[model samples]
Target: MSSLSMDKIVELQAWKLKELLKWREYLGVLVEAVKEVFNDRVEVYVFGSAVNGRLTVSSDIDIAIVLSEVPKSGLERARLVDKIWSVMENKGVPWWYPFEIHLLRREELSLLREAKFTRLL
Candidate 1:
């Protein structure tokens, strides 16, 4: 094989992730649950150490939830959290994979560093 061809192959295969991440599939399931809370105004992101191209097998998936509109009051936020958690539990999201959740209002995003997230919306 030519050296040039090998380089091309390497470039083409760079984005490929070989692991059978059940967590990724589970994310697909959980997105629906979160959407119910915001009525289609939510976005999900895979952030933190997990998606940084340097993840160890033990790295945790840091999920960031962005809502189009934030709750107006503390009580509303609590109720929304309760509902979202209930939905997550009902979905049987396999806890086998380590993860954490970070919720953010749409406007709050302006304060976050851009390189920190990989949008899954």
Candidate 2:
């Protein structure tokens, strides 16, 4: 497995701490929901401003989900997204806000490139 330097890990931890303070409850629920739905098929990460410690109350959540495979149809993925969104909304966790869900395939070239970049840099 690739390893990140202590400095980078510390930076990432600090960023996550700050984000947790803002959206702890919501995120906890979201994480649980994701785990329940995707099981072992997906991995989730927080990125963008939240990952960089530059988040504001107005800043929307940026979640990156890596899946073992890209669904053959966009509708399939959209359904998953909608299910998550509905759950979040029903849980009263601030729906109708701007947020981004980035889905990536585990075997995609872009993902491979990012892994290489992280390992090399």
Candidate 3:
């Protein structure tokens, strides 16, 4: 993963929103894949620029998944991410957009609320 500066992150967020609107159907498919992967163990949100209606043609997807339980290791998280990616690809959905997975425990509602961001999807 590449490190993104605050400004770059903000810009990317806005661009992602544009792409979401342009490809709403594909976004739905991605969301469905997330649901299938995590089941009731997590809540997936479409956050950042895409939700705020400030996206551009090059925006990437920023998805935040609040998990009921944290994975045992980073590898587990990576595997889950790969599974979601695979499902989207199998469905013939575009994978051009990047994903930002934000894992949170069920008890972290307060933290999530304190975070400054928008939920678009």
Candidate 4:
């Protein structure tokens, strides 16, 4: 069996706290970018490990962008992604940020209800 000393446990916790703080700041910038790009047309939510407090150094920020009207085709979705990326890039958000964006309609929001999430916009 293996055990961690109390000091080691505290050290690990402090590291996690620092990581969480970075993610929170990143999320704040993300929310602002979404607002600038989509205005009132979409609602954003943070889900998965980020919202559930299972955050780790390797965890990706999972976000769901609830749209008033979801794109109906693959090409449309791709264009939506491009538009968002363009706006985010213009706002100084890195294109390679460790995050995933899920585009959904209001009706589809029910599918994610089983997951822990908090509205960001």
lDDT of 2: 0.63
lDDT of 3 by residue, 26-118 (tens): 667777778878767566666556666666656655667777787879898889888888898888766665556666676765565644454
* Each model's lDDT: 0.68, 0.63, 0.68, 0.79
Tell me, what's the RMSD of every candidate?
10.1, 12.6, 7.7, 5.3
lDDT of 1 by residue, 1-121 (tens): 9999999877644523333245567776667777876675678887777666666555567877888676678787778766766777778864343556667887777655754777777
Candidate 2 collision pairs: none
RMSD of 3: 7.7
Off by over 4 Å in 2: 1-21, 56-58, 108-121
Q: How far is 31's C-alpha from truth in model 1 (Å)?
A: 0.6
Instruction: Report the alpha-carbon TM-score of model 3 versus the true structure.
Output: 0.65
For model 2, how does the per-residue alpha-carbon lDDT over 1-121 read when each residue is reduced to its tens digit? 2356877877876875565456545666676667666766676666666556666645766776777876888899898887777777776756654456666786653643433111100
Return the candidate ranking by TM-score, descending: 4, 3, 2, 1
Model 3 residue runs over 4 Å out of place are: 1-23, 109-121
lDDT (tens digit, per residue) of candidate 4 on 1-121:
2356877877876876665547676777777767776766788898999788887766778889998987789898878767777777776666766668888999999999899899988
Query: What is candidate 1's local distance difference test score?
Result: 0.68
TM-scores, all models, native as reference: 0.61, 0.62, 0.65, 0.73
- The model with the greater lDDT, 1 or 4, is 4
TM-score, cand. 4: 0.73
